[model samples]
Target: MTDRTPGFATLAVHAGAQPDPTTGARATPIYQTTSFVFNDADHAASLFGLQAFGNIYTRITNPTTSVLEERVAALEGGTAALATASGHAAQLVVMQQLLMPGDEFIAARKLYGGSINQFTHAFKSFGWNVVWADPDDIGSFQRAVTPKTKAIFIESIANPAGSITDIEAIAEVARNAGVPLIVDNTLATPYLIRPIDHGADIVVHSLTKFLGGHGNSLGGIIVDAGTFDWSKDGKYPMLSEPRPEYHGLKLQETFGNFSFAIACRVLGLRDLGPALSPFNAFLLMTGIETLPLRMQKHCENAKAIAEFLSTHKAVSAVNYSGLASSKYNALARKYAPKGAGAVFTFSLKGGYQAGVDLVSNLKLFSHLANVGDTRSLVIHPASTTHSQLDDAQKTAAGAAPDMVRVSIGIEDKEDLIADLDEALGG
Candidate 1:
């Protein structure tokens, strides 16, 4: 609104896109080919040497994917972005750049069950350690930091629980420790809260969710705030050290603000081999165009459903931060003032069996493992999403046996409430 620039809605549709120069194609054309032709040996040399920027291989970059990256970067107000095969891949690419063997990163105990598993098990295999901290206790984060700690990771709004994290407070902790704050803004898309604006150094997304809106595609992205001092204290070698592969070029010295994103692409994506397809990128871009509209409806329906459940005799508790009674309500107001996001967990008075029954009996709502769909979805995280965790781990992550998670959709609120009423036998 300040410099008379395009509003979010306008940027969503027009950012990073222009009329096709060759055929005037209005829609983004998927460059499905695996490689791009170079002008000559010098052009090829410059691209491969990292002296110039252009598409070399689909495994690293593509025209369609680049558009999605730029659009997301613009939305998040980041210097640059890199699209990946999935959200997990995006996190992996970011960590691969920062962490070395025996290094540790502190993370909030409450997170998506999949991310918890990924950070706990997969990262251990890489010789990288994960130290847990309670997001509710700022002192817990301070205690978790050590000399080897390289970063702090948290969700803007945790999945299933719908708990809102105080990103600014945690960012202060990271700043004091001289480490980057990596925020998983998957549930709270840029429309609701841009993590970078709240002091995050790197923002990651599960494009499979709200960013893609439809459940039709699997994609992810990492937006670089381009604010971190990678060369400070010489902690991030991938950015500060000269690379033998690129004729001893130091990425930070070369790219300046966007160096981290460029490192993720040329170094991580190229080697790890988790590239997003041009087709999926096209699908995600289409979904983002309607993000503002769908997200508003989602928050509206979620609030209505949360209100109804809170007063229901069969419901014991609801974890929606949008509710005034929620412990996270103030933090939600500070961070995601738009809404606390659509995904939240609730417990039934009937306990675990009742939770299972409610999921099974839902008529209009789907029982599935995925969220952020146009259609209402319900699942018992104890039995599905967080099934891999032990009892203590599950409880720590807020997936109790009596809990059922719901991803409220952009559907008719009346129909959605009616379905729940019938399902609960009211």
Candidate 2:
């Protein structure tokens, strides 16, 4: 049967999936087996020896997970993708595949609190250093680049604060340095922004967010654009050089454009073992079908809330890219032209106490840590998410003591505004 090249919506519903040959099932069935039966000893040898691609174990790959991977790659306009157990796991997998001991990467200072901890503390043990650069200043990225710099990392739309990065500018710096630009597209997703289209070599996402909209599954994905030439300068020995473990096969030579994804799965996932569950993959696939719809509504609701917050007497400042006054508005227009996304922050006039009271008073918005959910959610970052960071670090990360992060949902704008009105003592 000839595969139809459909539009985005059509591809979302049918990509990397077809009716099961055995049962004629239209829905993707979870291949709940740990291992697949091989045809013969030679076939098994070829699979294990990297001569052929087939599922050897559930920990490395699975059929259900493969659908999710393919769908995400198609959505992000990447050559291939690998699904991981969590967003953090995806980051670890990418770093493990690319970075060696004493190598470094440049990252935007404004990032998720958990990500900051992961880069600063956890990755340090592995001898991977992160050079923090201000995303607002594109020149900082170029200045931060060193000989040991392997990649440039930034969020398309930063978490909590919702600052937008100038992806093309940063990618230019990475290109000049001969390093791949890695973008965490978790907030913007592919519906609003495809980093690969903006010159990002690798794009990562937390599927637990908008991609898995219902908050039922925890998953992540790393998508390779397949544009970067790993062998050009021999910066990445793992991909450019021969692998002794895989029978002297070089990834760049064998997989061609998709060498990065192959390395991430074969080496990173093979060693790290952070594969997404088949059940989670199925849930994530279901969620992706409605991604365009959900994302549109999310941006709409978020814009309304941000506007309201900006005008309110109690609000000291609003940090949404949709706002004209936002520092990121220009970049948001260039990169995320569809929308600036749902996650943003607003600071109250009363500082920390007011932030605490707003959360305590809200009736509709749930006070939770997670973002990109179907229901509206809020959090006082200084008291909760960034509590571990000291005053200086918190301010540097845009997590002020008075700031409250809101993840707007597909709810009635009037109702959401009214809920915040009462909470802010309107």
Candidate 3:
């Protein structure tokens, strides 16, 4: 290795990983176990107290998951990260650190359907309120903010719609409100957009999607940008206050820049117990190695297909940021000039029933609710993912009755287009 910083591709393959010490294995080996045997009593005590960083239990941490966390942190350019069982778990851990009962967080309305459901319903059960804001209008975020606002959440590239967000603009609102900005970079991935590079204090991902590349593993991560001043206004007590569990140690005072990650691990993950499996972590890490290669192909295939859909007679609209006519194209060029990403929605002239029929007719594209698989996938969001939302809510989330979303894979562009053509023709 040279003195110069490693490029994105190099980081994808080599960051946070090396030959196994036990067998000199080139690839990272899964440390699949429930607990670790400390060398001495003091060693175990130090680990349990967070005095030293070492594995104690799989529920809190594991060597395999640690590598995944470190690799994701390096890719996202965050100071530290925590791996979770799933993306929703990542959000839960993050919000747990920032919000108390009856507190609030501002969220962009344009988000993944699963996230919308989790924020609106699941968080409400915990007394954590969600204030919905329009990502298209930055002023909405500012107006939604109140004294109780703990954080602001937005997707880097919104799901289904593939629209670009004004992260810097909304980040300003968070800064003025003295709240951290949380950006879900699952759709864009770090390969396309590093939200931390553009004023994001925290970045979250559903590794089930592109990061895992294949539909083989389910995982999530929370990355601490190490830029937020959690102690400045004392808004986040989880970080700023003393902890009885760790013998009254103040996390922010103790861990400094990466305190947020530590808090999520010690307080949230340790108790909530949404631990990622070591085998899943191993698979996800392997998927990340070829992220640079897979992501580029995903983007290229997506842009071509979006172009094809734009011209199809059955299509009323194509909601892809890569398309020049899209409302988010200018922002895309500014934020993600590399490519727009793979998952995008298009409206059919035939509306709701047509959407269902398209998915039914498609031969190559599998009909599924999930996205970011190596195989092309299709879904009628209004009927499946966004079914819980009402008409107005569905429209707001960009999952209109007429919309059909597709996650373009690394397969041949012509084949994908032909499949879409045949489906629409039927």
**Tell me, what's the RMSD of every candidate?**
1.6, 1.5, 1.4
Off by over 4 Å in 2: 1-5, 388-393
Comparison by lDDT, 2 against 3, better one:
3
Q: Please give the TM-score that candidate 1 achieves against the real structure.
A: 0.97
The residue ranges of model 3 lying beyond 4 angstroms of the native Cα positions read 387-397
Sum up the clashes in candidate 1.
0
- Candidate 3 per-residue lDDT, tens place, 37-96, comes to 999999999998899988899999998899999999999999999999999999999999
Q: Estimated TM-score per prediction?
A: 0.97, 0.97, 0.97
Per-residue lDDT, model 1, residue 149, is 100
For candidate 2, the lDDT comes to: 0.92
Q: Report the CA-based lDDT of candidate 3 relative to the real structure.
A: 0.93
Q: List the residue pairs that clash in candidate 3.
A: none
Which stretches of model 1 miss by more than 4 angstroms?
Answer: 1-3, 386-394
Worst 10 residues of 3 by lDDT: 391-400
Q: Single out the weakest 10-residue window by summed lDDT for candidate 1.
A: 391-400
